[model samples]
Target: MTVPPADNPARFLGRADAYAAARPGYPAALGAWLEEAGLLSGGVADIGAGTGLFTALLLRAGARVAAVEPNPEMRAHLEASLDGAVRAGQLSVHAGTSEATGLPGGSAGLITAAQAAHWFDPARTVPEFRRVLRPGGRVLLVWNDWRAAQTPFNRAYGEVVRAHTGDDPLRVRVLEDELPQHLPGGFERHTFTHDHPLTREGLRALATSVSYLPNQGDPAYPAMARGLDAAFDAHERGGQVALAYQTQAFLGCLD
Candidate 1:
């Protein structure tokens, strides 16, 4: 996986709804892992809570959620989409980022980054995470990698992105190699795996939600779409295909 020298931070903000519709949610097993870790002691801060997807899962698990997302478009979408949860006081949406997080020192028991960890500058954010967490508090970094080699449909889909997108953060696994070395000191690592089913439309929406695609239209976007369509045509069974995921979770405890 080649890392493109481009700033893709604000890319998802432009396609908030597509992101909400296309992106897969966290697996129940990871949720259970967080529950077992007991970092929800001061409740959980869903840092980088884009579109409140992970926030909803945390809320459903009965964890009080303070979702911090930097992009206004994403924050606004989260606010609108999460009204019911907000009204019920299960969730609160805030504007912030991994670096310079707005929460008070030692105020969070658990800090989680879901699919957004790669975007952060770990050198600065790791210490900031330490500052915000109470002693022994945990920082959970998570990602959902589509298993291209696991299924034919998945492999074909992977080919589409490889052929079109220049730099896709979703294309590879780097945490065990990248994250641990990037943040050293006090922390432990754990991993959990899961899979999900997606309809052909779901897969298409997923491709469209990627940051590399054009906001509206681009020559490459349609080609990527066509690649997905072809993959779906070959793999659709009973109106759906199983997309296997290796859901990786890295839990680091602050000393």
Candidate 2:
């Protein structure tokens, strides 16, 4: 599918590619968990699909997918990755945000937000999700959070990000409050943790992908980079760093 240039005034446009490369994808365990819970059937909506990371997994699991993403660059990456599958109509893309998905009401059997729910306005997004989903449809909001404080090297890296970006971890802060009230009755929560090894380059890319990071030419950018390098040097073993994540998944069924 041909995509237009990113026109959204959001800061994510510039870092979309970095995000695609650096960010971890949802765990295979999540797919199993969803299947065991009987939530992986009919059609699924990948809210904030972002480069098709989680979207690819949904496709691999034999789920029909509707990708809703507002950023054109990310959408383009998704289209490029899916290529012929998209042409054959196995996947579809919509230029929309979480709060306004632009899909038909009662069309989706499952909805998922992977690592991008924090950017959503829950007040609007929750209702919109309810509209798109069929009765008994499930919503899964998930994030892969680096366990920065558990290790010295990770903590040091976290400090650098805090000092430079002034933003907390990428996990959505509203899930705790919104999930209880925003979701209709019959809600449940699940969590699955996993680890992935990262090289110095991967760590740097992960840090720089944040929306708040300064670009290459900016003076603060170097400071941010240097800080990240120091953290990696401190804990890197065998030319790689062990990055651990507390991957969390929250699931709820819309009444």
Candidate 3:
């Protein structure tokens, strides 16, 4: 697929290769919990299913999925990589965003947005979720929060990101009342903690995968790469550095 227009939501363009190769996968426990809770019984609408990471997990847990994404590059990677599931009728990819998913009304009993809610407008996305979900259907908002952890490598990585963008790399940076205000039914949060170990090449890919930081082609990328290298050298053990991540999941019924 061709890239999205510059005026559109094309932030993930030009980095899909790095994004798919290095972004952290979700915790397996989350999938198990969702399956055990019966949330994965009916089909799932994996909103903002970038590169089909979380969508792949949902499929493994025996749920059919409609993986919806907006960026053409990201969606194309998802479609190409998960073509087996697509061919088997276990998966379908659609061109859409969180606020305006092109899924049918009441098409899914569970709606999920992993590592993506921060990109959505809750005022619009919340109601759009309700529109696609059946009565009593649930919504799950997920974020793999590396910022929640405090470790030497994590701090160093954050410093590089902050130096480049003047913003926290892994934080959603949403206002306090951004989505909470719209969740009249309230929400429950589940946390799963883990470490992701990366090689030198993997570390570089991880840095490039971040949308806020200077990418490989950017003029400032050399400086960013140096900072990341120093960080890695200071913390690497057996040729890898482990980054801590806390997968935060907020669940609620939107009916």
Clashes of each: 0, 0, 0
Order candidates by lDDT, high to low: 3, 2, 1
Tens-place lDDT digits, model 3, residues 1-255: 122233335777888999999999988999999999999877899998989889999998899999999889899999998899999999999998877899999999899988876677666777888899988888888888778899988998888878887764324533335557435577887899989999888998998987767888899999989988999999999999999998888887764
Candidate 2 lDDT tens digits, 1-255: 111123332667677777778877778888877766667776899998988988987887777899998888989989998976698888999999887889999888999988776676566777898899898788887777775326666577678867875644433344465666445655667777767677888887777676667756668988888887888888889998877777777777656
Q: Which numbered prediction scores highest in TM-score against the true structure? A: 3
List, residue by residue over 1-255, the lDDT tens digit for candidate 1. Answer: 433223444667567777888788888877776777665657778888888878877876778888998878878888898898889887888887787778888877888888877777776777888888877677777778875336676677777777876545534444566767434654566666666677887887777777666545766677677777788888888988777777777777644
- Give lDDT: candidate 2, residue 182: 48
Candidate 1 wrongly placed segments (more than 4 Å): 1-8, 166-174
Largest lDDT belongs to which candidate? 3
User: What's the lDDT for candidate 3?
Assistant: 0.83
RMSD of each: 2.7, 4.4, 3.4
Q: Runs in model 2 with CA error above 4 Å?
A: 1-9, 166-172
Better of 1 and 3 by TM-score: 3
